[model samples]
Target chain A: AQSVTQPDIHITVSEGASLELRCNYSYGATPYLFWYVQSPGQGLQLLLKYFSGDTLVQGIKGFEAEFKRSQSSFNLRKPSVHWSDAAEYFCAVALYGGATNKLIFGTGTLLAVQP
Target chain B: EPEVTQTPSHQVTQMGQEVILRCVPISNHLYFYWYRQILGQKVEFLVSFYNNEISEKSEIFDDQFSVERPDGSNFTLKIRSTKLEDSAMYFCASRAKNIQYFGAGTRLSVL
Candidate 1:
């Protein structure tokens, strides 16, 4: 079974400050990782995804994540966060075929940006 | 620009009553899914449907929970008997190939 672990439940970043959210997964094979954001009273929105290729993947709203296989981590980063970036973020892993292939989500990390 | 939309933004049902949540995924999407989030909990996958059959389902999707794509544009999840515990936001999602798109979600309350 593939699962995700987001170590930080809450993170506060000031406007113009860099942000990093930690995510770790447990999967037997190469994992398909994704980041999703949900604003207040909204549905989950895709940030980005990683299957293979470059270790660093860029996403919308200037978000990026690096896939580290050895550490089983896919950490999201942003050089400068805006006030509008405050939201709940989730990290998930997609199982390969025959393994159900469902996206299992993390508990989510709450981001608070101060202006 | 294409997005998944769900109907009955909020529903309040009595315990033991049946409730149906509807969704219209992106017109051309081939795969559909249902997920739920209990308050302060993770987004848990209930089931995934493709080719008119269930591709996969989690343990939380028991006999009480059922899914059907009655028409080309509609996908529905039905609960035989609603429970207080079932009171949560149920989200509908669609997938083109790899990434899934989610709907705004239906908040179901069982009193």
Candidate 2:
């Protein structure tokens, strides 16, 4: 079975400050990794994804994530955070070639940006 | 960019009543999925449909839950009897390959 873990339950950062959210996963093999953001009362939005080649993957909203195979981590980073960026972030993993494209998601981290 | 679309942005149903949540996946996508997120909880997978049949489903998709691709464009989840615990946001997704696109979701509130 595959599982994802996000260590931080909530993080508060000042606006314009750098932001990083930690994510770790346990899978039998290299899996398809993804980061998604959900605003209050909004649906899940794709932030970034890691599949094969590049360790550093860039996504929408000026966000990016690095896939570290050795540490089993894919951490999301942004140089500057905005008030609108405050939302819940989730990290997920899915089997590469599995018949069912089911994603296992982490508990999630709530991001709060302070002015 | 292509995106998935779900209907009934919000739904309120009484306990023991039936509710149907609908979705329209991206036109070219082949795989369809249904997921639910309970308030303050992580998103959970409910079922996956492919080739007009269910390829996989989670334990949460019990007898009370059912999915159907009745037409060329619509995919629906029917809950036989709603429960208070069923109050949550139900998201519909579709995948062409590895990346799955999601809809805004239908927030179902069972009272």
Candidate 3:
């Protein structure tokens, strides 16, 4: 089975500060990783996904994540944090080349940006 | 852009009653899925539908839960008997290939 772990339950970052959310996964094979953001009263939105390409993957809203196979990590990063970036972020993994599209998601990290 | 849409943004139903949550997936997408998020919990997959049949389902999708793509655009989830545990935000998703787009979700509240 595949599983994702997000160590940080809550993180507070000031505006203009850099932000990093740690994510770790347990999978037997090379897995497809994804980051999703859910704002207050909104649905989950795909931030970015890693299929098989470069380790560094860019996503919408100036967010990026690095897939490190050795560490089993796909940590999300943003150079400058904005107030609007405060939301709950989830890390997920799907089985590579599997018929089902089921995704195993982490508990999520709630981000808060201060002025 | 094309996106998945769900109806009844918030629904309040009594326990032991029947409730149906509806969704309209992206027109071109072939696979549809239902997920739910309990308060303070991660999103959990309920079921996946393809070719007018269920392709996969989680243990959470027991006999009380059922999904149907009754029409070309409408995909519905019917709960035979609702319970307080079923109260959550139900999300509908659709995918053409790898990326799955999600609907805003319908919040089901059981009383």
* Winning model by TM-score: 3
In each prediction, how many residue pairs overlap at the backbone (N, C-alpha, C within less than 3 A)?
A: 0, 0, 0
Which docking class does model 2 fall in?
medium
Give all candidate RMSDs, comma-separated: 1.2, 1.0, 0.9
lDDT of 2 by residue, A20-44 (tens): 9999999889899999999987778
Candidate 3 residue runs with Cα over 4 Å from true position: A96-99
All candidates' chain B TM-scores are 0.98, 0.98, 0.99
What is candidate 3's lDDT per residue for A17-103, written digit by digit as tens? Answer: 999999999988878899999999888899999998799999999999999999999999999999999999999888735446887
| Residue pairs of candidate 1 with colliding backbone atoms | none
What TM-score does candidate 2 get on C-alpha atoms? 0.97
Q: What local distance difference test score does each model get?
A: 0.93, 0.94, 0.93
Better of 1 and 2 by lDDT: 2
Point out the worst 10-residue segment of candidate 3 chain A by lDDT. A94-103
lDDT for each residue of candidate 1 in A1-93, tens digit (9 for 90 to 100): 678999999999999999999999998987789999999889899999998899999999999999999999999999999999999999988
True contacts preserved, each candidate? Answer: 0.72, 0.74, 0.59
Highest DockQ against the true fold, candidate: 2
List ranges where model 2 is wrong by over 4 Å: none
For residue A39, what is the lDDT in candidate 3?
95
Error of 1 at A28 (Å): 0.4
**What fraction of the native alpha-carbon contacts across the interface, defined at 8 angstroms, is recovered by model 1?**
0.72
DockQ of each: 0.68, 0.78, 0.72
